[model samples]
Target: MARNSYTIGIVLIGVAIILLLGKLGVIHFIASFFWPLVLLIPGLLFHMLFFNRTLPSGVLVPGGILTTYALMFFYCNLFGWGAMSYLWPGFILGVAIGLYELHLFDRNTHRGVWIAAMILGAISVVFFVITLLFKLGVYVIALVLVLAGAALIFRRPRSW
Candidate 1:
């Protein structure tokens, strides 16, 4: 229980830090390639060191992959990398992760991870669909998805 709380706190702190960096416009100047690599390294290390005991290795691998893609997308957007093409890569990675979680990972925790990934993957799909259907409004869909994700994370049961 304590470890779960610590993990949740760390995740929230990480999110807060990213938001703060964005608000300060520090993320805008960072190179598009750098943020994903930077986030991937520490994210993998932290998963290995702190979360390994709680999360399965298979789940961790895909989770880290998704995180890397997400960081890449964020960095691309912040640095104005033109039309947000990185989102496609991120969505692909997310769907791959979800499939891996659903098929390859046979663990007690697989259900939760798979469900979460599916929800996120659906949101990503929706964003892309909306962008295709009406190019100017996709950002609003993404924002809504982010808020929903944040709320889900914040309200997640600690006992699990």
Candidate 2:
């Protein structure tokens, strides 16, 4: 239809202008500040493709990984690189989450693999949280007290 063609043409021209502006540094916000979008776009594209069935479910692994890592990098950029030491495990956990998602979506998935992925993802998070807490100077004594309290609350005493 003529109307649809006109709309498409207008969109193309808009894209051309934006690209030109980016090239000319007239859109410094895109070139400098929104760089994380580079990672985010493809990561989201991967998921969209998977959901649309354009790509196999296996793609979820990389998609989740890229998206999570991009998020982590964005977070680090906002805070500081020093947090990376504590947050490094999150990278692996992100992939694990993706793998888990793949397993959930794929009927032919091997349960063992997905179970391992979930376990690994959990380990990554737990390890990082403990590390972060320690780095923040949560005392060993405090941890011991908390653990002892939890044990007392959860475990019933045996009758003699």
Candidate 3:
């Protein structure tokens, strides 16, 4: 009976601590900031397994992908989700990174994998450029116009 009472008391204390932490927002804080670790841990495990020879190089594909995505998520979480509009290209880059890793680490990798990785990487770059231009293009255009106007005003031939 004494052992049972002690166990019950310990369990109640543990529950109370958990509840207090949750109420204090500590649990939410950890969950929000460190949730990317859920993806990162498995990704790292895959890499470690490959390095240890417990898994084949094929695992690197998902490993690279997950790690990249986890990093991207962490960035968004730290900054803001709005940044994802510009960072969406990172998704394509993640696959490209995975394929590149496979090409680099796999002994039996083919030329096709390298080509695919390059194509995807190029696509990601293109998307990033387009997104940036779409988002900040107006500011750039405004600056250019202002500069052109200043140059015209300062020019010697002010007749026109």
Candidate 4:
């Protein structure tokens, strides 16, 4: 019961903070620039306070919540409703760190493996796009190299 109440209180506080910012048009102003980076300080503090020495599930839920917030902010920016342009990179970085932490729990886990894999996969996709646009043979080589790197990383032991 106490835990439930605490959880509800935290949720309410978060909502209240957002509402206060919205009501004051602070979010609108902050979104007008790269001020969203200011979120990193509290985010880091929260991680240090609650996530240190925690299990994967503990980190995952909060990480997901933060990622969702980031996405919504990004969407608002993309739609011209906000001003921040570098939101997605922060979101990606947060998710990458969370995934890496989660991977720390299990020796056989491949969760963090997707972080690198996704980057390489994106490179391949970009190369494919370039190949379509310019008929570039070099992009094919780039794609192959990216895939090889991903494959090697995936196949390597997670013991390190």
* Highest lDDT against the true fold, candidate: 3
Give lDDT tens digits, candidate 2, residues 78-99.
Answer: 8978989899898778878788
lDDT of 4 by residue, 1-160 (tens): 9999999999999999999999999988876755444444445455565556544334543554464455556566557653233233344445555555445543466654556636744654555455454554678779999999999999999998
lDDT of 1: 0.64
lDDT of 1 at 47: 56
In order, what lDDT does every prediction score? 0.64, 0.85, 0.95, 0.58
Give the Å error, residue 140, model 4: 12
Off by over 4 Å in 2: 1-32, 139-160
User: Which stretches in model 1 have alpha-carbon errors above 4 Å?
Assistant: 1-33, 44-66, 74-79, 85-103, 110-112, 136-160
lDDT of 1 by residue, 1-160 (tens): 9999999999999999999998887887675445566556655664564354665555455555656565765667567776565256465555556455444445555566676666776777777775565655577678889999999999999887
- The parts of candidate 4 lying over 4 Å away from their true place are 1-38, 51-57, 60-93, 105-160
Q: Report the lDDT of model 2 for residue 96.
A: 88
Clash count for each candidate, listed in order shown: 0, 0, 0, 1
lDDT by residue (77-146, candidate 3, tens digit) is 9999999999999999999999999999886999999999999999999999999999999998999999
Model 3 TM-score on a 0 to 1 scale: 0.83
RMSD of 1: 21.8
Error of 3 at 26 (Å): 1.6
